[model samples]
Target: MSVYQVLERWGIKNYRVIDKKAIEEITLGASILATGGGGDPEIGLLWTLGTLARGKDVVLIHPEDIPDEVVGASVGCLGAPIVLTEKPPSQNVLEKAFKQLSSYLNKDLEVVIPFECGGVNSTVAYAIAGELGIPVVDVDGMNRAFPELHQTSWVANGSHASPAVSVDDRGNMTIIDTKEDNIRAETIARSAAMAYGGISWKASYPLTGKEIKEKSILYSQSIAWEIGKAVKKARESHRDPIEEVMKKLKETREVDSFRVFNGKIVDIDRDFGGEATKGFSSGRIRMEGIGKYKNQIAEIDFQNEWLRLKVDGETLCLPPDLIAILDNETGEPIRTDIMKYGYRGSILLIPAQERMRTKRGLEIFGPSYFGYEEEYVPVEKIVSKKGCQK
Candidate 1:
């Protein structure tokens, strides 16, 4: 049977035989879901596209198909994005990381799991899955992108990223076994990245299908894919892409997302001193709201991902949730590195996933974790108070 027939037999209606076009769509959607972080999707896109060019079949499997005993590894690159761009990565790094992880765990992974639904991590899972001749699981730790490793549902739901392996371009490697402390694993993995010239590929979060089913933000990959396809379809048809986004969020995620503002970026106060000094890009953005929001000002703070959003001095969203800046017409994500003065976009908001709304998740990645003195108020509540839809 042909691949199409096989896909049909597997009931893979939601699954796409990841090709060049599919990669582009997935990257576009994942980047928007990345919440203004996850690095440039181009980096991840290039890697996946290269793999596809080699005639590899990168198949995305639904999370429900993952068996109870089958194990998976969280595949990702950890470090500052600026550094990653400068240092680049070796094609062999992921393979080495996976080997080291498997050898340490004394078991091979049946599949790969994305740590988060960012552009890179989302594609990285597919990239590794294809390279390993395995399938990529649809589940992910974060439904939206987050900055640190520990902010994911794996940690929020009491799992860890440890017993991990970090590999550099030069074939050098470090095996980190934090004995279940995900935060310490992040610190150690981060320092390793800095030491290895600021970018390291890692295979961590070894989990059984059962554990992942219990802890992960199940079906996040499919959510990102559906959201992306909606935007793509809308754009191709010349419809309102933002409306497509809202519709996708409600239909696929069963969650309400809000378009809080539309505006032009007026200023970006980035931490310019931190190209090498800091491991992550930290900054604030200012935008002049347009149209009906004329004369209104909007602000957002970030450390990799959008952490806080405020309009005219009122907070509309905070950490552990999501804030994406998308092009008003095309629905493409406008990342921090790419956002420029005078760029027009709409600010979209999504509530944190239920798995990410737990008490521990809040303690680890809530607004306070980003240094906000105020507790997180649900975006729905905030929008409703403004008399918006639920």
Candidate 2:
């Protein structure tokens, strides 16, 4: 069935038309919610906006409406966000990635799911759908954003991210078809991205519609839209937009967003040397906790996304969850590419959902996977136990 018919049945007649202005706002909101990783929004936006100018519609489909038999996959650029900032994507990246993957699989794709709700990955899915004359699913792997490729709801549910096809703007392509192990797929793709100069176009996670419905986060686009609208409203009214967003997402209750550091970024230590070698960005950020957090210290270690967060020598946050650094003045999210010394921001923490805490999910993204000595602990339990919040 058509995506339009499905939305109609759901009483959602008007899916937000992502025009130029709306796309900008949506991208900003998505970036803020991206939790410090998703890739460059500008690159993703330019590609998507160009596709829109071609007079094709990017339709969104509800998860449940997709038939079980139809094959679906996600399309986006994969590589160092730093590299993307320097080398903008060619307009044909998504089309080429999808085409190559489809040819490799020897099957026509029925739908494209956005890997995440951020600016680039979110809209890139629609651009590919428009090019291929397919519908983009309304749901996504993550309602917020995560750093790693395997951290999707699909992986948590047992669908594999293997056989991922990655292509460069130069038309070079590589297909990774490992058995069900996403980390292996990540390693292969990361190597390809490095070989291709730190950035590569990727189409991944080919699954059936039924598999997507069962495993994916449904109606997440609607949730992002709501969060975006709330932020916009908060901005216009001169209120704390961050608080408004936190309230809307119920993120405060879910996890404690420490006003940990309000100071300038004193230094940034990047482990990968921005080489894009390992499919992950390894780095540490040092910030002097300012304002109410004055005279305090905050440091974050990252591998792709922020892994461990420490404030004043106390481990405040950990992985399998999210930590976002935003512009204190404007509330705009700071990307790893643009994060620099003297950039003042707040550290917001939100708990990972129960779905991500499954044995399988933990096995993939647990503390041990990242070399932390402690075992995986739910954010709620950790926060409550430490008295970080009442």
- The TM-score leader among the candidates is 1
Q: List, residue by residue over 113-162, the lDDT tens digit for candidate 1.
A: 88887868788778777777777877888887876777888888878878
Name the 10 consecutive residues with the lowest summed lDDT in model 1: 1-10
**In model 1, where do residues sit more than 4 Å from their true spots?**
1-16, 272-277
- What is the C-alpha local distance difference test score of each model? 0.82, 0.73
Q: Give the runs in model 2 whose Cα sits over 4 Å from its true position.
A: 1-16, 144-147, 251-261, 272-279, 385-390
lDDT for 297 in candidate 1 is 98
| RMSD score of candidate 2 (Å) | 3.0
Ten consecutive residues with minimal summed lDDT in candidate 2?
A: 251-260
The C-alpha TM-scores of every prediction are 0.93, 0.90
> How far out, in Å, is residue 382 in model 1?
1.0
